[model samples]
Structure formats: C-alpha cells, structure tokens
Target: MTNEFATLSDFRALLAGAALADADMFAAASEHNMQLTKPPGALGQLEDLALWYRSWRGGDNAEIAAPQVIVFAGNHGVAARGVSAFPAEVTAQMVMNFQHGGAAINQIARVNGATLDVVALDLDQPTQDFTQGPAMSENEFVAALQAGWQAVDATADLLVVGEMGIANTTSAAALACALLGGAASDWTGRGTGVDDAGLSVKTQVVAEGVALHGGQGDGLETLRRLGGRELAAMAGAMVRARCLRIPVILDGFICCAAALCLAKTQEGALDHAVAGHQSAEGGHARLLEALGKAPLLHLGLRLGEASGAALAIGVLKGAMACHASMATFAQAGVSDS
Candidate 1:
C-alpha cells in the first residue's frame, strides 16, 4: 500500500525544500494583484483565490503550468425517484457532450487550454459506450484510483475534479449528511427543478438511504453507502492529490460532497482543495462553509459538468500572470516614506 499523507502538515513537511517554488509564486502573485490598476483589495475573492493558488504552488512565482480537469461520469440509481428533472439517461448523454466538445465545460476548457479527462465509474447504472473511457467497477474504482493517482502524480500543477450524473446531487447530499455529521434533511435539496411534492419525495428517498446505511463511521462507510463509484473514486483521488502536494479544485455540489468525504477521512485534505463554485442547491453553501472555502464563481449554475471550475481557470491564470509580471513597489520607484 502506498503511504498516504493524512494531513496538510505531513504533506507540507514531505514537500520540504521542494516547496520553495510555491512561496515565490504566491509572493509574486500578491505583488501583481496590488499593481492591477486598482486598490489592493479591490478584486476581493478573485485576488484571494489567486493568492491561495500561489500558496498551493509553494509561492515559487510559478505559472499555472498545466491545468487539467477530470470529469468523473457516472449514473445515479436514485434518479428513478423523480428527484431530478432530467432522467438518468441524461448522464450518459452529457458524457457524450463532454467528449464531443458540445458542453459548456468543454468550451471553457478549450478557452483555458486545459486538458479534460473523462473517467466513467460504475456506482449507479452502467453505460452503453465503450469508446468514452473505462467503466468503473469495484476493481475499476481501485484501478481508477491508482490511475488517478498516477495521472495527477506530478506533471500537472493544478487539477479540478468534475462530475456528470443525474440525481448525483441526491447521492452527494446523502454522502454530505454522513460525512458532515448532519441529518439527511439538512443536506437534501431539490436537485434540478423538482416540484414541492417531488422535493418532499426526494428528501424521503435520501433519508431512507441514510437510515439504511448511516452507521459506517464517516469515511469509507459513508462512501460505500451513499457514494457513487465516481464519487468514491474521486474521494481517493482528492486524497492522493493532496498527498502528492497538488491542488485540487472541486466543482459544485457533487464534487464538494466528495471533498467533504476526503476531508473527513484525511485531516488536511481541505488544504489541497479549492471550491470551484457554489451550486444553487441548498446544501452546497453549507458544505463550502464547513470547509471554510469560498468559491470563485456563482453564476447560479446547477449544471454538473465542471463548467464553473473551467471558468475559474482564467481567474487562476490571471493570478499566476499577475504574480509573474507585476513590478514591486521598489521597482516602480515609489518611495517608502
């Protein structure tokens, strides 16, 4: 078994002297933000997110070297409950869009020059396509975890994990309830645009699932019970990314739930995570707050295609560019009285 650094401190110590680059990158980015032709704090969260990215990179004045987004595709068995407005088949259809470059996330990825990797995990229903990617099974999940570990091992400086599955929000909510130490009622929400009655039914479905599988002790058990294969696989991937000292950007609710699982399992996994956006769903805000993370975008988007993370890539790039290009107060010949 590979040794997993369980906390941010351990990961930090592991990085040791190699982490110097991260510091230079952050300091440079901070200086550049000050020279953005505005007041120092004008950009608010954008400035902060950029600085945060710099910190993650060891502040080595590093550029956003290779930004990659992995879209974890799966199906949710719970969509049969009418919880989500779209049918479960939409998951596979959207995967097709992701592959064909027809989705919003695809456009954003293209614009940012980020490579997109799609992994299909089998936690919900199985898909019919062989050309998309590997089908996630029990063995496949572990293999994907290993593959995820290797893919994100070193070369890429930043990675974002995105998901596509109708009714995944329900799975995410249940997982949140277990991992966040809350009741199902606290995390469950109208996933797509369910009617009031549909919402009520949706909550009951999640509640029942929680009741059936609630006592698994918050890590793998929570994953085993409420997690889809993709969610489970991503949970491990998030931990591995943190262990490898790479930053992981989480897409909306589903991804946040996966992050929550990893954070609960590993003490400082949250340190490696950047919340990409808050979903319109009710529980997403609570999840972000639990992690003490603020998202980079909130376009009221509920789509689960990693689009928000893709858009935030630009903000990160800007932050990196600002750090690399901005002149210092001394360089600008501004006297320090």
Candidate 2:
C-alpha cells in the first residue's frame, strides 16, 4: 500500500527536517548511558550510533515502525571474467533459499522482528525472456530502479538493502568508479577470496569495464554498462528511501556501491543512509570515507546478504529504547559529575 508520486523537492525537505530529533531525547539517552555504570564514552561508537539514531528520528518517541529488509537478488553475467570464485547459479539458489526462509538474513530478520522481502529481478534469468542476458538498456535499468521503489512503498518504515549475485562486486566497483569518478583499482576489491593471480585478473577486468563505460558523472550509463540489476534496484531503493522519508541500512562493499550511485544521482540521498558494517574489502573504507559515513560495526564480514545490517538493527532498537526511556539528570535527581 505504498504511494508513488512524481518527484517533489518539498517532500524530501520535509522528510529531512522531520528526522531532527529533539534535544531532550539526546540529553536523556546520554544520561542513561552514563548511569549504566560505565564511564562516559566507554561504549565508544555504540553510544554514538545510539545518539545518531535518536537524533535522526526527531525524538526518543519516534517509533522505528514496521522495518523491512529487501534482498534484491539477481544474476550477473560478468562473472565469466573470474571476478568471483563462486558460480553465478548461486544467486538463484540463494534466492530460493531466501524464499524458503532458510537464509542467514532470514534468521537475523526474524530475531530483529523485521519483515523480510525478496525481490527477484531477473535481468539475467536465462529461461524467461530476452536474448541479451548480461547487459541492460537504460530503460531497463531505470525500470528496475522504479520497481525497487514500488516494492518498498508503504510496507517499510525503514529499509535494509542487500544483493545476491556472483561477480556483482565487479559490477558494483565499476559503477562506483563511474559515478564517483575514480579508477577501478580504487573501487575494486576481492570478491569471494581470489588468489593473488586472480586478484590481478579481477583488477584488470574491472578497469576495462570502467573504460568501456567511460563516464565522469553519468550514473545511469555506468549502471547500464556494468551495474547488475541488484545494484540498480539498490540504487532505486536508496533514492526511494529519501523520497519516502524512510531511513535505510546498507550491507557491505557491493551495497555501498549502490549507495554511491544514489548519492551521485540525487543531491541529498546520502543524508538518509546508515552504514551497517564495513567489509574486509579494501575499497569499502575508501567508499565509506567518500560517503562521509562511519559504519555501525566492523566484524571483518563480507557476506553481503544484509546480514550486517540485520545485526545493526538490534543496536538501533537499543538506541531508541535509551532515547525514549532514559531519565535526564534533573529527573534522576543526580548531580552532573
């Protein structure tokens, strides 16, 4: 029951402004954190993340609401380049696993009380329709983007975007290079554990793809040239989150590349994004740095099925609880020490 509308700047502005949480919420949460019997700043980034969530919601009372996790699953034809160790069939198999509620993300979402939805965008599905399986037209890319928005519509209060496709990391790196104006070597990272020789091959292959696309700032062109459907759908989801006023949690390196696309596509899409975790990929930190985002955790995880974001949801909930239930120093009758 999501509502779709023409692009509106006023809507985005209103949404952005609404996220500014009140000062009392912050004061209370800080006080509560201090009273937890730990010295101030003891929790480090966890406290910061809690405070950030409190501020983002405009108050401690701002309900997280019906949070939803959407795993955009697709097969990338570019895996033929040895960019990934796993076969592309893994994408479809994982999607089937997700549908059967047996994936890691599924269990994580269940624990977090988050609704999980799988959007199977068959851009490279061989049995279905088109002859051109690997590449996509601009129209198709845009359509996939819109479809992602359409899927998340009113059902999600917050969205966690994840992708499942082998070698799509190459596609993601190339897309990041195109939109963010960097070399493929700058964005490319190891996918599924390539050896030294395989890493060399991967770097060269991604560089060639970036050169083939040849764009300084054209996000759509870059996506059509090297971005997979999962990435495009991810871009669409990020944009739609801004338009719809729902915050989104991004997974790892490949998912961050999708964020890079939306950041370049729209002027302010980055403001609504939350990084779930940092990956072992070398490019992840650089990308997060470029985005001015600090991730919620760094567990050296590279499994990209929104598992990282799912883990962060627990922290986000704890943050909201502190914001809402914490008593201020004055209310607690405690002296500011």
* TM values, all candidates: 0.81, 0.82
lDDT agreement of model 1 with the native: 0.69
Model 2: per-residue lDDT, tens digit, 1-337?
Answer: 3434333333233334433344675676565666654457765776776665554444434546578888998777667766788887888898999999999999999999899989988735611111123257655666667667777856566789898887877777776676667766787778788888877877787777666665633455556567777887787777666655577788888888877765665555667678988988768888898888888889998889899988888877776565456565667787767
Q: State the lDDT at 186 in candidate 2.
A: 82
Weakest 10 consecutive residues, lDDT, candidate 1? 127-136
Clash counts for the predictions, in order: 18, 3
Q: Give lDDT tens digits, candidate 1, residues 301-328.
A: 8877778877888887886676666665
In candidate 1 the C-alpha lDDT for residue 134 amounts to 23
For each of the candidates, the C-alpha root-mean-square deviation to the true structure, in angstroms, is 5.9, 4.5
For residue 216, model 2's alpha carbon misses the true position, in angstroms, by 5.5
Q: Which candidate is the best by lDDT?
A: 2
Q: Which stretches of model 2 miss by more than 4 angstroms?
A: 1-56, 63-65, 123-134, 153-155, 181-183
